[model samples]
Target: MTEISDWRKRIERYRFQGSECVKCGARYYPSRIKCIKCGSEEMRDVELPRRGRVVSYTVIYNPPKKFSKYAPYAVALIELVDGTRVLGQLTDVDFDKIRVGMEVEATFRKLYEYGEDGHIVYGTKFRPVVS
Candidate 1:
């Protein structure tokens, strides 16, 4: 990925928000320059809240080839405070303890390795937000 893509995907992992079409009022994820619902190129960037609750989830017993080492991990669809739903991996906790409605917080962590050059990839993940 290019520098901009890396910056957008890595540094901006804390929260996800997209512009709603001022003309039609639609929601978007991963953001886009154009509103898919109304095809309006004019849009704005919105920052979503950091906390959310798990609405649904699944444990990946057999993960992808690259993620096989991290098998039996939990992934969830979380609904943020702003009502935006997103899918992400649950981190730093036992998979069996995860459940629907469990509160989580956005966090950035290492996702994978690129090559022998020590280039690491990082992305956003969710974890139980201790009060």
Candidate 2:
């Protein structure tokens, strides 16, 4: 009954991190085995920072049938300090105050839940850095 996504382990580790393809420099959030750009099978694992800024975002009024309960949430493409842009949910603040360039930090949070498997999926999300 954890609150983090299992896939988060792919990108959220302090060590054994992800990286862009050296051959093509294609950004892989979870460190792919091959360059998604050039299809090269060589990739270098690199540590990513926990800080970034909002590159773009939107408020989801209509969610999937299963995710309808969590509708009216803000989703954003956060551009990390290393220049890698990743899409994630933005939390912990008023929706109206969210801005295009607002500073944010990585924070894992509850995304959704389902089934009788008694599992609570958690994933890495972002929240406004409180001043």
Candidate 3:
């Protein structure tokens, strides 16, 4: 992947930065310039809540080259309090204990080293919110 794009996303990469449609009050992650639901150009930036519930997940026994060391890890689709769902690697909890409906929270951690520049990419991962 291009390191330049990573650098550009640094500001919002470690946070739940998403876009909200002012027209329909719809929200999205991996922020979109236009509202996908309402086709509205009027949108605003919103920081989603850190805590969420796991909607779905899968354990990766085989991971990509960069993430091979972290194999047997869990990636979850988490639904934020505001109902915005996003994918994040689940960490800091036992892999077997990760289940649907489990509460989790956003965490900033090193993702991996990438590109020729060897960028030690840092971004949001998720951990169970011990209730």
Candidate 4:
């Protein structure tokens, strides 16, 4: 990804911002220029629900280069309250305890660092919502 778009996506993920079509009330993640459902350009920015449930997940044994250190982690598709599903890394819990329907909440954590003395990137990770 280009540096500019990476910065743009980082902000959206960190803030949980998505798009909601004002005309049809449809919502999207990573946002969109136009509503896919209604073909309307009247879009509004929406902050997504911080909480969601694990609808599905997979254990990744081999991650990419930058993320190899965090391999063998669970990546889950969480269904948010407003009907949008988001994919995020599950953290702060044992892998054995992860399962479908597990309730989780978004938490910001360090994803990676750039070159030495460069910026340290932070993004959303999910953990079991402690009750």
Per-residue lDDT of candidate 2, residues 50-105 (tens digit): 78999999999989875798888999999988788778889887899999999999
lDDT of 4: 0.85
**How high is each candidate's TM-score?**
0.79, 0.77, 0.93, 0.89
Off by over 4 Å in 2: 1-17, 22-26, 37-39
Better structure of 2 and 3 per TM-score:
3
lDDT of 1 by residue, 45-69 (tens): 6666779999999998877776787
lDDT of 1 at 22: 65
Q: Top TM-score: which candidate number?
A: 3
Clashes of each: 0, 4, 0, 0
Root-mean-square deviation (CA) per prediction? 2.7, 3.9, 1.3, 1.7
Best by lDDT: 3
- Tell me how far candidate 2 lies from the true structure as C-alpha RMSD in angstroms: 3.9
Prediction 3 TM-score vs. true: 0.93
What lDDT does candidate 4 reach at residue 57?
94
- lDDT per residue as tens, model 3, 1-131: 67888888876777768788999988887888999898999999888789999999999998988888778888999999888889989999888788899999999999889657777889889999876
Model 2 clash pairs?
A: 3-122, 4-122, 5-122, 5-123
